[model samples]
Target: MRKNVGFHSVRSFSDRRWLLPFLASLLVSFTLFMATIFGLFSSQNVGDSLSLDIVSFTTLDDFENDSIGTDRKKLLDQPAIMQEEAPRIAYLITGTKGDSQRMRRTLQAIYHPRNQYILHLDLEAPPRERIDLTMYVKGDPLFSQVENVRVIAKANLVTYKGPTMIACTLHAISILLKESLRWDWFINLSASDYPLMTQDDILHGLSSLPRNLNFIEHSPISGWKLTQRARPIIVDPGLYLSKKFEVFTTTERRELPTSFKLYTGSAWVMLTRSFLEYCIWGWENLPRILLMYYANFISSPEGYFHTVICNSNEFKNTSISHDLHYISWGYPPKQHPLYLSTKDFNRMVKSGMPFARKFAKGDPVLDKIDRELLGRANGQFTPGGWCNQTSSDEMAEQCSSRGDDSKFLPGPGAERLQQLMKKLMSQEFRNGSCSSLQYDQTKRDWITPKKPA
Candidate 1:
């Protein structure tokens, strides 16, 4: 009788264990059902509040108007966005034979301790000139102290009309990328280029911009020049030759590329570090493919970056459609732009462009610019807020010593640049970015064929 009673007790406990778990599961299900019903009802209430009928008490137009005005006022009251530190620029100044002095002058005019500079005297320059350039860059006290200046040791045989020029530019960019990662933008300039503003003004103006913008004046390659540029098969001997040589054309003509459209633009460019990284690193294959395609293309410098940037979905919208340099061309245009002189100074200034190109080496207009616009005395670096010499009496020795590089005292130049930037960022400018048909039309008009008279 005792054994049977113990067995019955164990069976009863086991049954009760199952009952508890079942009841707990039932409770959880009930809780979830209740929560779902509550959520549904709350959503219905929100929907009702948003309905058109609710606007009877407060007219929809009136509410919208009030909200829009309030939002605008709030946006206006918000603090302006600014960078925590002054932006740094990386400059690649290229030159050929007989450009040593001019390159040095341009370097000093644009030099700032906060920026990095790389000088490339191409293989066309004699060994003595290259040595002299290297010595000058190394001998400068400020450059030695700051260690921001570098010279390309292995000079490239660059052909301006061939892919070699683009290769040289890329080589310099690679060096800059490896040397310092702090610079925000990379600006490419020839020895013929000169700055119209001080580094302080540039930094001040650029501080307000998004860092990813690329300034490259670009349009599609079409019309009269299309057959000339795209159909020819040319070989650039600079790629394999130890000495410079002109590009030679083959007898065979090929069809225009069906894989990708061709684009052309000014060779001069100011590109962002991120976009350059994308080009150099090339996690995507577009940059590499276009590079190979342009290897045989004439004047690759004019088209390589333009084609790459416009074709890239990632970087197309980031293009600003301006080269940021003031250049003058003839009515019908020519292979080379007309050399700028004193006569063009007023127009150059009025244009509000920061840099101008193809200035004759040591032109009097450069002196005028240095005197009036840059305030840089003979053989002195451009004066900036970073220099302690403020008095006119010390003009001769200004920029010899350093002050607070972090501070900037921008003048009229900065205001002009700001105005230009506002215009570039306007709705009109935004609408014109990477327009396929519009670019083709512009190219057609630019190189319109004359009637056979």
Candidate 2:
């Protein structure tokens, strides 16, 4: 009986020891499982609160109930808004010695509050002449009030046939881009150039057109003259010298380039702001490369922009084959176009060109254009919607006071310009743009149409 009792007590003690350990392990596991579930619920509550806070801060009441997919679809379906107002032009009016007055006249003729103007008198002009021009620009009440006219304080020494002319043009364009953020096109003119239409007419005519068009008369470099132009290397002294000098040729000649084809065109051009930006910024290396290559080429102004535009795929299709200037050349042509006169007035009026070039200083024909086409008198601005008067007495003194520049009063000149633009934008002209290699046969050897006999 004693042995049996001792054995039972030992067995019971061993079983109790194991049973206690098992109970402790079970209790620990249950506590961990409860903690994990509480942690998950706490995290979910915090996430919901953060989402609510973001929604409340942004105040997107309309979109609170919208799904992300629905919002994206709505945004995709919305149409893009476009500007409907008349486009603004940036003008660079350049001149040499004794051209200050002509430059001012041209500026006044083309003046509009909406347009930006930069007048450059080349370094060849005396300091007195430049100062006189600055004084004239500052002294005018209208110019001062509008503050759209600017005179380049530091002028460039420009050789008309050299790359310096192109440099000056790029300089002016850079200034225009910096000063005004809204101009659509850039038009370059010389002191000898004159406007054939009122600013109102021009603004109205340009308002309906695509902003990407660039009016540059270009053709491929070809024939015997191509060898004459391409083979001989020339250096322009105007790049470094303060005084004017002709370009000198080197004895060594170079082979024509195999990489890119060469093109030539009229120096007078009306270019889109976007295209000029591409040239000026040179995001691609083509503009800079061509600029360096043409540094030694004769008549670089006529070819630098021409080559860059035609070679660039981005702008080649955008080129138009016209320079939009009315210039009369003698048959078989001279170094310059014939000096325009009253004899050419009727022809100039009928040509539907907005501008003409190579007019002599104080030409009588300018007065006829001012009187008949522009409706301007008494040395005032060209009459337009900006400043027109109904009174007969006020008609003589119109544009003397400020008026609404946003309004456009297009007239017979607008109709004429529209006709010309229509023809230039037709399918035939577009199909041949930058696609042909016609050689320039006119004097100056640039691509320009001969005056109709």
Candidate 3:
């Protein structure tokens, strides 16, 4: 039996309960009373733990309506004066050559003074292009003043559709973690991706969540994927050669890992800081073990993090198994999802996903998103409550001046995102974790075993 913590019980004033539970409640009350008489609040203070991050299983509306945790209760009871203590996201936006301008535009659209951004143009981009990106970041008045936006000076040779993608991601992650290390989560995006919600909506929605939960969409390999993906052995030349080359497959095949089950998913992810630390610099051996194993795995980006997370018993239960990106797979499937277009706008907005990917550059569809979906006035940052500049000058208005970074004015995005999270986090979805399946030659699909409750 699990030992119940005595500190959690609330005093029952009007309820009739069993003697055991009643006595437990009385005991908890007495304990707190005694603690108050003395100085025993230290138990709750783990490390600079003054902030009440206990709104999990609760929403911002709930925070307003009810008397919640002691500190949150007190805060809610106060007048609606916003305090500046919101969490910040560290973004690693990577792209290859010919994507510098798109990356720049994406960066500006998502830019906030509070968040850290690391833009990378991989080795496929010529030296001039990389220099141009760095110059762009350095020259921008807002970027220069905030000092949170950075362009990768030393670019990695990222192999298209290879483990190099994950490597480049981790490289940026390591630098950020080592340099500032204050971010709550590390979100990886490519230049092709764009945010569907304002930063205010994104941050406010996440503020109520448990900080440790990782949002990675993943599933077990079955049928076609198991054979077509796992059995193949291919080496990425980006790992050794200066210039990127195609992956070469060996005639040999390998067996699935006995120690850990393999998982696969979308490359886009919003990973928790604690999990990132484990994957990058933890004392544990699992991260390194999986890294070496995936060196020869085709499309390692999909499987690398998935395998490490699902295989570790500790993290499996914690996986929400959703990459949180709005993407549409073509019927019968294709190499990449159908590039999001104007036709997908209504569905995209209703999906409640914070980000969507694979848009054709400067597509008129993007303009529609900017105007209607994101509320970003033409080529401007998403207009949030944080924006305070006068709306006269197009370039120097609204986003030029700022308010408290912590304040939030979440629009429809928050509501949509909350519903999406509810589905991913439901008991049924979580219990149906990454499974082991075998291909049925006749079925021409994965034949999965009956799952146990």
Candidate 4:
């Protein structure tokens, strides 16, 4: 009798367990149904307030209008003064191990109160070095006061000639976009790169131009380069591994993509913010699709942004077909350009390029550039209109104090850059079959094809 009673009790508990869940679910359904009848679930009631603010749930005009709104705000705020002054530029200065000092020098050379600077030292740099750099930036009174400089605290492991290089660049762009909205252009430079002109000169030269122009060097991929660069499959260990390693090539070769064309150019570029936004936000699918395609391509940095800009319809016409860099290459150019020295200084200045690259650390030519081109005193910020000019006795001390950032003191460097821009925008340069104008090493400037007589 006792055993039978226990069995009955167990059956009753199991039956009641199912009943509780069933009742709970039924109660939830009833509550939801009551809410629905009250119009709580209706689209009109739920989204009416949101709809009033958002022009449409569909179409991208709203997104474009928001960007235009910012522009309108700028126009309303400054009217004519802001339009005449130089546009704010955002710089991504990247370096690796043993490059902290060089990065500092480059940073000082290009420093301006009106501009934004972000420094990135890849994982290859030691933590102590990174910390020291952060301290240097923070310890400076001018940088702390104006607050335009930032360092990437969490650095990425960038593998040379790999997709990681592209990844690091895109990461920096996103951070800059989030931190500031006033910048008009994004320029990428490595520690090895140094500015030939002051920030004032580059700013003044670019002030009159259309803000949308992208100074990227690009040429269509064809023949040998296509076969060698595009067909290979590569895996950058830096993507998965914590430590740095060389990218390995796979035996499997992929066919050329038929959807979008491939373009190649110099790794460095001076891109407009709007184009970079499209690349980063991916309002359309092309940027993402190409990003995946380039992940395995050799030297992705050289081709990723170039391919994206060329393939994009909205941005294609805006490309200026020049990197605005004075890069010297040997005859039948090797994989890397010759390490620049005093010999290249004359040509670098004549090229009218704003910057040059692959300079050796502690090179004597750098000092000469400082003395002649930048007018930057050793370990001092490049003097600009932003530098306070109180007394000649406190010349170095004057730069320590900030002045009217909007004020620009244009110099001879601006004139040189203007001439280069004129040639780049000329009808003959724009109408060429290929957008890339080759460098005439002998002539020491761009070879703009002569107009047919």
Give the count of colliding residue pairs in each prediction.
0, 0, 4, 0
- By summed lDDT, the worst window of 10 consecutive residues in model 3 runs over 437-446
Q: Write the per-residue lDDT of candidate 3 for residues 1-453, one digit (tens) a residue.
A: 123433233434334458779899999999999987554356355533333444333444452343343354343233323324577799998888799989987887777777899998998889999898899788877677668988888888899767888899889999988896568878898899988887877888777565656778788876887788888888889989888789888899999888878888878788877678779974457899999988888888898988888876445545677888889997988887898898998889989999998899888888887776567766467766677755534422567566766667788888887787667655556555552332232442323456679
Determine the backbone clash count of candidate 3.
4
List the pairs of residues colliding in candidate 2.
none
lDDT of 2 by residue, 1-453 (tens): 889999999988877877788999999999999998887688678785655556555654443354542554454233312248888999999999999988888888899988899999999999999999999999988888988899999999998667898899999988877765579889999999998999999999988676767899988888865877877898889988999998888999989888788988789999998789889987557899998999888888888888998998666756888999999988987657898999998898899999998799898899999988988784677878887578745754767677888998899999999999878865556556683321221221113234449
User: Each model's C-alpha lDDT?
Assistant: 0.82, 0.82, 0.76, 0.84
- TM-score of every candidate: 0.77, 0.77, 0.75, 0.81
Q: Quote the positional error of residue 261 for candidate 1 in Å.
A: 2.3
Q: Which residue pairs collide, candidate 4?
A: none
Better of 1 and 4 by lDDT: 4
Top candidate on TM-score is 4
lDDT, candidate 4, 362-423, per-residue tens: 99999999889887889998888888886644655588899988887877789899899878
lDDT, candidate 4, equals 0.84
On TM-score, the stronger of 2 and 4 is 4
Q: Which TM-score value belongs to model 1? A: 0.77
Give me the runs in candidate 1 sitting further than 4 Å from their true place.
1-82, 435-453
- In candidate 1, list every pair of residues with a backbone clash: none
TM-score of 4: 0.81
